[model samples]
Target: MKVALTGAEGFLGWHTRVLLRALGWPDPVLIGRADLADAAVLADRLRGVDRVLHLAGVNRGEPAEVAAGNVAVAEALARGLRRCAQPPKTLVYANTVQAGNGTAYGDSKAAAAAILAGAAAGCHLVDHRLPHLYGEHGRPFYNSVTATFCRVLADGGEPELRDDRELRLVHVTDAAAALLDAPPAGPWDAAMPALRIGVHALADRLAGFAATYRGGDLPPLTDRHDVRLFNTYRSHLFPAGYPIPLVRRADHRGELVEAVRSHGAGQAFCSATRPGVTRGEHFHLAKVERFVVLRGRAEIRLRRVGGRGLVRFPVDGAEPVVVDMPTMWAHDITNTGDGDLLTLFWTNDLFDPARPDTYPEPVAAA
Candidate 1:
């Protein structure tokens, strides 16, 4: 089913997007706030979408600005849904966990819910409410407790607790899956705390999850067998729901660099692996790249920022050719063939996020 998702690049939203795709839904009309002032324009843009998941808001903002910005976006989303020729079957509102008359963020969300409730006709309105959500994508606040504790512990400082700590915690992927899986809520489920947890326990739980994750190997090490990967130092957490790049097969295993590339930029090497192996969900910018399946087979998928209709290629050794991909197009190469698919890659420049390169975006739907 078609859907409209806001804050598509943010932690929760991206997880939700990934979940929806996993559930066999098409890519939703992923949107980031373009203009809050023009509610009508925004609404018109949202018109005729099947489902609109609103997750745009600031947890920490000047109370007035936060309230106004949030209320405005809700108003615009409602207008957009109303304008839809066929009202959406589901209009899921991603309300914060701290709802009701609690903090300013909570208060604003409660108010936004009111606006949305009024806009529904036959629309199923489900308000996904949860406490601090935790997971890989949640780097800062939502994952604040985990992030803080992890940073402190890694830096040789024990995590400090502010006595009497209590709060609900939801895994980001789990919460996102819940939102997508939540059928239109019955009237009673509106603005309800569907889930909850405590602060100290939350920290302990995350720490435990981190510790036992990937069989008690911790963050950087994927597995104990790869322990000899003495040079491997990848800290990013690949939450279960997302892609886990099969980087450097055992044969090429010893050479894994944290740096994107060593040579200038024009050179690159990617994998079209053994029939059962996969490559990655990550890509680089400023890298004029080319991919060639030297053996076996591959399914090369490419996508861009706001574009629809991914470019798909299911190639085999019988017909192997290099595909040149410009920076605007972020791509992933997979070995869908029965044998090892060796892919040759060449890049235009070295990796540099500051040079307007390397966007850590969602991998295409499998």
Candidate 2:
């Protein structure tokens, strides 16, 4: 079914788009700032869509601006809905759990919900009251403290917590799933805390992840929350912390190199590719994958799902290095040498054909 999405470039919006792509859902009609400002444009965009995910709003501005901005978008959308030739079947508003809490943002969110409800008279209105969301590529200092900490730590800087408080954090992907009505996403209450931790504890936990990962080793991802946190941390180090050189010890015997070392569960496999053969052209939603060249020269190329430029890395088996793939980025490795190319692949989870978590996308595409 066709879907229309506002705030399509925001952190949560991007994750929703990624989830939709992973699920093989139809492309969404992106409702940008221009569309939101013009009711006629928004109406045209949402006219025949099966679902409308309203995710745009201002949350980090002056109290008055924040409240007014949030309500304005809702009013624009309401106007658009009324103008639609065929209103969307469902309208999901990404409201926060703090709705109606008397704060400017909270009261504004509550007002937005009411406005949408009145406009979407016949449509199924889902006011998804989400909690604190943290995920990959979230804006530092703007999205959440998790993002800020991750960015500071990843950039070799320390993070200082001003006021420690409890946070009910949820992964953006999970939030995205709930917004999309995707399967395995059970009924999530407005304030369901997937993982609850104090500010200090969260900072320490993220610090531990960074320290372990800095040494080219995966930390103990004992559960889903840990994995999600680790992935979020790793997201900040992409295209910079790659090609992790392995410690090659040479003594009396042949040189030895540690290819895969993880404090978590994973699967490893090797592949031999003929010269000029490309091995992968896929992206993972949450899988942490690593590629190590063992016997030949190759070029590893990666491109973000919705990006245009390509990131190329030339690798050689003679000097082994680990290149971990970031989530949602399409990647591929090709044998550039004349002889057979040997490569080792490692993932954070065992292969499950039923749920491979892999999606096909060419890295060469712009």
Q: Please list the C-alpha lDDT of all candidates, in the order they appear.
A: 0.55, 0.88
Where's the lowest-lDDT run of ten residues in candidate 1? Answer: 225-234
Model 2 has an lDDT value of: 0.88
How much lDDT does candidate 1 score? 0.55
lDDT of 1 by residue, 233-269 (tens): 1123311111212223234444332212222224466
Model 2 lDDT per residue over 38-82, tens place: 888888888779999999988998999999999999999899898
Model 2, residue pairs in steric clash: none
Q: Which stretches of candidate 1 lie over 4 Å from their true place?
A: 35-44, 141-143, 154-157, 182-198, 201-366
Q: Can you give the lDDT of residue 134 in candidate 1?
A: 47
